[model samples]
Target chain A: MRQRLMEATVDCLVELGWSGTTTTLVSRRAGVSRGAQLHHFPSKQALVVAAVEHLSDRRRDEMRRSAAHLPEEGRTRGVLEILAAQFVSPVFFAALELWVAARTDAELREAVAPLERRIGRETHAYAVELLGIDESQGDNRQLVQATLDLVRGLGLAASLSDDARRRSAVLDSWAAVLDHELEMP
Target chain B: MRQRLMEATVDCLVELGWSGTTTTLVSRRAGVSRGAQLHHFPSKQALVVAAVEHLSDRRRDEMRRSAAHLPEEGRTRGVLEILAAQFVSPVFFAALELWVAARTDAELREAVAPLERRIGRETHAYAVELLGIDESQGDNRQLVQATLDLVRGLGLAASLSDDARRRSAVLDSWAAVLDHELEMP
Candidate 1:
């Protein structure tokens, strides 16, 4: 029931933005009574918070699934492709919308902070694994963090633009980030 | 007087979103009489539209100024740096809130379309001049478009994470896009 409610939240988010989302609306969308919603979520804010956690868990699982096929020899390229696909996928747009909505609401921020930390940890860990680099190495760890950030930014840009060629270049450039020779400004 | 009104509109946006923006609020914030606001701009929508235009013009002018100082050899890098800086800057966040508000409102979209087109044109033109690549040329021109989109995404991510190092890598990777060997998998 909680999972169903969380899934319904994404459906509602796609249809109605943060301001438009209400407990009654969500209950109707979920085909559950108002009392049931209150029983499960306690409040509308609580519902959205659970939805955020749901989305984060989904992304983490998806990332791991995609990365499983990466060959050790071409791990860097493979990991980049997996990460790129995960971020740029159409399904993730709802999560992105929720994240954008979180900026204005303190309760949403509280819900999102842990998710962000988990994502950062997973992304950094993936990067270190792909690069075969030690995170304990000073600049190297920073490089991993920085590269993860770059991919996130590039992914967001690719999703928003109408230009296809530009989007492709962003993906390619992202793949190249793992190569040391590509680091020169 | 017009500038003062636009400044007030921006302030109003930072505090209140689309539903909250009104003639009364703008007049109050600007310390101008409703009569005076009517004298300069007849409607709240018109005032908001004009503010959008003002911001677009200001951004274009700033981009030009920043690019003008670039040494010939570093022109491409400098142009992108200026463009990326515009994203990470605090003023841009207020502008961003307005952009999101505009997304769901038809009047706002109609008003802001010209600004979006002009920015695309200017960015493409600057890329052509600075990179010495014709806009009509092959993927070379596409590379420029991609870099611009990437920067926009990077900027959005930076807003949430406050990670400057990641933002810099985004810009750096964009600079490296020219050298990437893109082949469709």
Candidate 2:
């Protein structure tokens, strides 16, 4: 029931944004009574933060799974496609709502800050494992992080419009560049 | 007076986020009456959209000025610094507020879509000019676009925390890589 509510909260954020998401609405979407929601998560911030944290875990898991399944041939492009898919997911949209909302809300920022840090660390670790790169190599690590930033920014742009062709081009260009920079397999 | 109101709107967004930006507050900050504010923008959507477009123009002009005045010998690092500064500016945060709000608000998205498109085009053009890269070179252009994506994504991360040291390192690393890929001047 608690997990169900968290998932529903993320859904509400993706569909209604920060302003439109309410504890009452989340309860309705979760098919639970307001009493049940309050019993588990007393406040809207608590619920939303919980939802974001849950999402981060799920997203991290999904990335790991995708990375594991990527075939050797053209795996770089495969990796880019996986990252691109994450950017377009509802979970990304939900997290974006928190990022924007947290900018001005100190309490929300406090709650979200650690979660983002954890997610960032997990993402980099998995990316290194996925690409078969050595994280101990300083320059390679930096380049890997750069690839992440590029894919994330492209994802943000894609949310506004269909930039698939251009995005893919940029991704392929970046993959070639990364191959030389990190000495990737 | 009109400019003041728009500037105030951007200020409010940076300091207060989207929900807290109201016409009354904008007028108060702009030192104008409510009537004056309405007379200029007529609605909050109009005011926010106009402020974003205005910000885009100013940022482009700043990028141009920075490019023209870049000192030789270490111009590469200087250029990255300028881009980084722009990404962390109040204007970027203000525009980010609109982007998140527009995720669920179709009316706001419709108003912002064209302004965002124009800003994106101008940003790419200035980035090319600033880097002294030949856009006719297909590989060079793709890398330039990728650089923009990297910078924007870094900006997004910096907004969450003070990652100045790491960000500068990434900037330097990417600049060296770009010198190899795009043949930067």
Interface RMSD of each: 4.4, 0.9
Task: Encode model 1's per-residue lDDT on B27-66: one tens digit a residue.
Answer: 8888888998998899877887687667656776777776
> B66-170 in candidate 2: lDDT tens per residue?
678798777666777787788888898888888888868889889888888887787788777777777887588888788888888887887778688888889
Candidate 2 colliding pairs, count: 0
lDDT accuracy of residue A173 in candidate 2: 91
Ten consecutive residues with minimal summed lDDT in candidate 2 chain A?
Answer: A176-185
After superposition, candidate 1 runs with Cα above 4 Å error: A68-81, A88-91, A127-165, A173-185, B18-20, B35-49, B71-80, B102-114, B127-139, B169-185
TM per candidate comes to: 0.76, 0.96
The Cα RMSD in angstroms, rounded to one decimal, for candidate 2 relative to the true structure is 1.6
Chain B TM-score, model 1, reads 0.80
**Tens-digit lDDT string for candidate 1 (A49-130):** 6786677678768777767777866566676666656566543555566566665556676787677667668766876775
lDDT for model 1, please: 0.64
